[model samples]
Target: MSIVKEFKHVNYLWEDSVAAKLAGDEVALLIYRSNLLGADLRLTNYGGGNTSCKTIEKDPITGGKTEVMWIKGSGGDIGTLKRSGLAGLYVDRLRSLENVYKGIEQEDEMVELFNHCIFDLKSKAPSIDTPLHGFLPFKHIDHLHPDAAISIAAAKDGRKITQELFKGTIGWVDWQKPGFDLGLQLKQCLAENPGIRGIMLGSHGLFTWGDTAYDCYINSLEIIEASAEYLDQNYGKKGPVFGGQHIESLDANGRKRQAAAIAPVLRGFCSSERHMIGHFTDDARVLEFINSKDLDRLAPMGTSCPDHFLRTKISPLVLELEANANLADIDDLKEKLTPAFEAYRHMYKAYYDNCKHENSPAIRDSNPVVVLYPGVGMFTFSKDKQTARVAAEFYTNAINVMKGAEAVSEYTSLPRQEAFDIEYWLLEEAKLSRQPKPKPLSGRIALITGSAGGIGKATAKRFIDEGGVVVINDNDSNRLESARTEFNTQFGKDAFAAVLLDVTDSEKIVNAYNEAALAFGGVDIIVNCAGLSISKPIEDHTEKDWDILYDVLVKGQFLVTQKGLEVMRKQALGGDVINIVSKNALVSGPNNAGYGSAKAAQLHLSRLNAAELGGDGIRVNVVNPDAVISDSKIWESGWAEGRAKAYGVTVAELPAYYAKRTLLNKIILPDDIANACFVLVGGLLNKSTGNVLNVDGGVAMAFVR
Candidate 1:
């Protein structure tokens, strides 16, 4: 039952070879072992665990050897840990400050002392659990909130049961907010129980240590494996099955469609003044937990551990759908679910009022981070997709822990006061407080058409960089896929979604909007950037060329804008729409009848939408850009050379020729146009609508009055 010995992927010899070359071999080994532990989701979720190694580092300046503990730094996850992610603190200095803890009445001051003990001033702040690692005599330590361990740790009489299962190989500590006091308690417990190899903190997690990283890691694996084995022998088959006659009628895709249909409504209801993006998951386990009969009794008990409180509020919102309600009718579902969310908010306010201390920060927005719908699985919501995903992961793990514990006896979590204390603890809050200020459109979602390259791509990147989630759309599948990969790589995998479709097709446009809604709850801004250019004299222009230009330029803008308006209305949040028209709309030119007329009409359509949607708080605007032909697809389709020939310049000199003609004498880049889009959509021009912001490098002929 030793999982580490049985793990076939890890090569101890290779790890030793790599660690042998490092000056701080213990630190190097710690990093390698931390990564291995992080690779398994069963061992850690996101950045939930910490690891440390005690070693002696000779001071470069003083040439004196000093004991040091290199622990995983705050905000660093072991999965991506590097040398920089581990903070090196002088253990002697930290132990010397033990007297300082007596006078430290506030937890924040103790945290300050922890930072003060760092040997390298430039190193990241040490993990808050540094004292625990430093006080232990072991050379290596690993602490994780593994699901299997928590199943035993969160059970009723958990300490007694864990003692029975481990047979005194592990010591138990009562749940305490992780701080100087808890660290001292752990050190005292280990001193009293000299033979214990590991310790389980009731209602929290486990800590294992040994003289070597391999020993510590293997001990953790064995402890976890033993916990799993115990649970399997005692309660594996006692839990209720997930699906029965209730969900048998619907197939997998049908259930997914139901979840997709209801996610936006749930998002809208859960969101406060600012919108929240919903991440939907119906993984078999999630479905089982949501569909379980004991959901009402078990779901409200709170997070399995205090670490999850910040991400997924103390408890999830459990909603029971009407037995005969229609899932396909979104409006009807919204009507039925609105009161449940309102009641959840009311209950949360009451809980905060009763449990919060006077020094506690103001109550957070009362919207639930996790929502449980009987037949529709679960929906986790947050300001962005990444946090939502993390919440969903932790909640899924919580379900496993709860089912295992329930099967044994009854699952018990930390009391509500303890959960609230950790949630609002100043030390815990300080971790997030260190983040930089958010951008203007931090929580907003935008859908930009033609985002594969040029102005559309630039605009999408700008939105993402400024803390907005964007759904990139384009008719070019290859380019769209490439752009998606590039954006996801630069930002995060959850930052962007790509939909390949023609904006001119009404049916496809509607489906694309639906796809965007499902991906990021709903759209907050819409950028109509899909278009082409055709240069032909009025007499030479054929009907086919005119139709093609009109369909893509004007009709495309109309269809996309209309669909965006519908989504915005459903969300009941004010939105912005930026139509990427051309300078030809403001100023006419010969041999530009097809392109110019269509753009001019598109500009008019924006004005009409602005007029109609003003009362709904939807701002409609147009960005008129010119001479951005260098990387645009329109130029690659033969329009660039033809336009250069008409202007009496070579294709290479076309950009300069247009630049010199403008009053500013500057080459207008796609990024410049993207900046204008940001200003209009990012609330800088909140009070203005039905207006055209020109990014044409100050074209005198195209200046609007």
Candidate 2:
């Protein structure tokens, strides 16, 4: 391995007056900041890394003075880190220890150090690398198995390979278990060459430190960026060629198609952008790693580092492709994928059986983190979007490292049990246990009218997001197709349906509802958002306009609710009906004779239904939205105007205007409406019914009767 000379890195975050007493005001800030840095770096995708700060402290009870250490508490993300996230430890205890009392079998030693060395027994387990970080002489130390750094390190004869690429610049370390023994080894190596700038952990990561914390963070970033740049320069390739089978381009239509596909996946996975599926395919690494076969083995070593280890575990699916192959067809893709998934589960169970505590919860499901379908490439899954995206990046980086390591010698990873222990660790198990799955709505069916617009669509999305299946209906065939494509794409076929039928037609409404129940088992909720408006003063109101408005706004709602109540009461399963009315119903509005009258009727209708359906356990409510603008008549009319008259000041500007009308100065969106629906049917409002909820932008404060 090539070792580079050390250089002095400047760290601006440290105070020169930092005192020897640990937990003192100045040192407390330093320690807190150091933990923040560790959490930030580690919380990054494939960025399982650690940071530590050394300080001297006086023991309060014993009245004796000693050096103390504080490290990142185990099990939390750096992104959400605070002062409380740190685990307190006795530095003197660690520094003075001559030798590990327990024999140094890697796994056992790691557990012991974590349990004994850390003074905060109730806190999260100290990272397995605490000993290594503690052994370093630097006051501020940082270690990260950055995807970028490890990707380069995992190359065959990585020392020589990287030497050729980086020259005699980067320091290197052969892979070693991270604990007391490794700590001692690093202490000796640094002593031999005190001038080294950083340590490159072979098949692992890179380390950088300074006398202060700022230098440590910046140094780590610089080294990682350098490695990333090197790979981009040497190994980067153009986008994959699909053999002229017409993979969609990232155009407007392409984006719509992509959104549809992605939306369903998000819904089915019960993930929000912040939860599990966000950023899943946003990174280049997802695409690159999906196209490779390095995910076959089970090892806690992971794609890159520890944080992202949960994303892809240490294994992904491996697939091989012939000269001619098709990746677009779902059936063809599944043919290659199904068996691989089965094998991965089989292997995962074996690993779990070998590693975990006997009482540990059995593996819930055997879904591979990364799916490598050879010709079709690979994909990654996680509990959240960021995690999945980060894992994908780590896999790409790891693939590069593994390929290089293979070039030097056969690239191999740790045994199955070790990875299983890390993957199914008690700490991680706790995280999974804390997540409360969406209830009551999970697997239930709901039908939403006017679902192609903001509120209806948003409500449908919310229901689907909460694990309920939704059948979205719209009069406009185009909009219906759009909703269908969007929901199907995001939730897969399991969570969504799109029907093109106008609610004004009573026969059609009944038929569609029957069909939806037939298709998805049974219906549980109905949101009547399919209403029409006619802006005309009483004197100017036409017979046609009045009739059409009443037909859709009042008649349509009545017909659908009537049919829905009948079906719901027959099934004897309590259900819900939400009517989209208007806040303007409470206060009068000019040029809204037909629309206002119809909405007023719809509101009273909801109360009547609520009173009648109470015994059947059905809930009926009205949502009076004042000025929420989505893909609706107002937005379309404004867009079609093309600015000459500025029909409604453009769809984008509508929110600000609406917000200004509200006391809170807040413009509500579809999601706000969805959240309200979540509360209503979510069984939180179990006792109340015949109520009108206002989702308007503070237009009026009068409660619905």
Candidate 3:
């Protein structure tokens, strides 16, 4: 594939002549170039590369010109980079520190020195590679870990191959752990070879620089394209291939079902008490790699690059799957997979024990982050869906790089000791330390039905606030999209996903549950909050009204709960199921026979499920809320007027009328129900099941015994 250069897009940034006339023209250009590099996954994986431009800016306090390096900041992707993501450091101060940190040995101390050179006190911490950028005297610098370059850079004779391909156009540096000393080495290399246009660091990545952002970007593209051309010339025809001989019997749906069965067992094995989500892909290249005869020898050869060790473990776990395995029986699948996982853990522990040093931090979990199953292809696990996707993408790139290298010569990896050092590097650990403390449900996934508005929306938001990923399902497509946009704006784009589903339709419910499982590893919490209130006397209630109420409140809850049970059972991870019932379920209300009776049936169904699922450690509970008239969709459907008439009060006075009747004289809000749902599903009521939590401001008649 050719590199994409949209020069017109770059020119448009300066078109607002007024904004460009003021300041930050260079910074804006750097941001645009960085985003362009980040946009191509082949050029850089998520948050994997750094870029910088050297410019002069006047100090706010001193009113004197100062040379500064505007470099990409930590913990943000270059694709969506903004002004805030670029850390500006005083170049003179950073360059002068070359001698000050000359003999410092600790990694943390070098990082401290790097932070001290920040020109803006409020700016984010500069990238760990800032020194390498600062040491170079170029007007602009770009460092990328492109897969094509990595295939060439990570080989046994990487330096020789790079020199042969670029022919003095690029310089080479042997692999050294990145820090102050490596920065010094980079400077010396440039001083020794002044005519080279770029530097290719052994087993690491490539560095290119020029006088302008456009020049540097083009230089990077050219170098990478040259490497790609070399790979094509050598092994273009004999690339890795996958055949369908083994799975010729199964259709696409059958293959997906097989993966669904196997994914949960793998996810449960990888996860500890803290949940982890798994993503699976059987892409042609991945399948070819897994099904190869030499997989056993090639899989454990270490990561494609050093940075990948941070996301994927040092190596992937290679598990063998039978050619025509029967995955319909979960017990049989678990039986076959359990021993393999155990062995993998033992092997990982041994690897860590042999390489650990005195200063090394505690060994990370022994579970493999990436798992390769012969028939299932690759599965990547992480605390969240986005991170899992990132891991999967990097591993896929690694496979391509290895294939290219293997086509030329044997694939080589860093020594185990060096891999361990980079894996435990302080800079990598610091990124994790910078995050806030995780909430109780941080990595769990929740599925909330009827989430377009009212109690369901509130509950979905609450789950997201607690760091849990959510799936919001509603039959109304437009309302669901609107709610999804709002949630995405308030929380994050990946915080929740929206599915258009009518819960009463069994087929739709099944598809929605499957969608949730595919998006996340599996569902850990199910909140049954989809319902419509019908305020009519028993004599006035029609057969159609009865069917609708029963279908939504009773049958819908039954179908959703059953689907949730199937996922929980397959995952073998304990989960929570919460039914949003009503106060009328306990105490009969006038003109509310249809709604109240259906709710009562739902409450009973939850109790029965609690008793049955307790053996599997799944907790089933119910929340009974009273008179949540304000901001409720049930009220919008004429329930407000009906309830107001029943209470002999106007619609505006209904809330106060119900509030005065309660012992606490408080109006029940949607948030109150949401809080109760959180308590049940967030593990606060872990030991209690089949219990009803009251959220009605202490109603005298509706209080649970």
Local distance difference test, each candidate: 0.81, 0.60, 0.81
Across 1-705, the per-residue lDDT of candidate 3 in tens digits comes to 123454311121222343344345788878877887888877878988789998998987699999999998877788888999888999998998866674637645777777778888767788778888999999889888887888888877788888888998899998887777778888999999988999988778889998877678788877887887787777735444321123332445655666666677777888854689777777777776777766777788876577676788889988767635777788887888888888888887787789887877777788888988775668898988788888888888888777767765667877888888788776677777888887878879899999888899999989888879899978888889999889978987667778898988988887787777666777889999998987877798899999999999999999999988888888888899999998888997799888888988998999999999999999999999998875677887878888888889998898899999989999988889999999887766789999999999888787778
**TM-score on alpha carbons, each prediction:** 0.94, 0.57, 0.92
How well does candidate 3 match the true structure in TM-score terms?
0.92
- Candidate 1 — which residues are off by over 4 angstroms? 1-4, 7-24, 59-62, 103-108, 239-249, 322-331
Q: TM-score rank, highest first?
A: 1, 3, 2
Q: Please write out the lDDT profile of model 1 over residues 1-705, one tens digit for every residue.
A: 212255332222225455456535788889988988888878878888899998888976689998888999988898779999989888988887777776436655777888778887768887778887888878999989888888888888688888899899899998887877778878999998998999998878999998877788888788888887777677546535422224422456665666655666777777765678878777777777777666777778887687676788978998777423576665776787788888988988888888988788878789899987766677899978888888999998888788668767678877888888888786777776888877787878899999889999999999988889998978988998889888878987898888987987988887787777667777889999998887766787889999999999888888888877777877777889999999999887767888888989999999999999999899999999998975688987767776877787899999889999998999998899899999997766899999998999889889888
lDDT ranking from best candidate downward: 1, 3, 2
In model 2, the runs with Cα more than 4 Å from the true position are 1-47, 62-65, 76-82, 96-100, 104-125, 159-185, 188-195, 214-259, 262-304, 317-361, 371-380, 396-417, 426-540, 543-676, 679-705
Q: After superposition, how far is residue 328 of candidate 2 from its true place, in Å?
A: 11
**Per-residue lDDT of 132 in model 3:** 88
Per-residue lDDT over 355-383 for candidate 2, one digit per residue giving the tens place of the 0 to 100 score:
77765667655555654432233345554
Most accurate candidate by TM-score: 1
Worst 10 residues of 3 by lDDT: 7-16
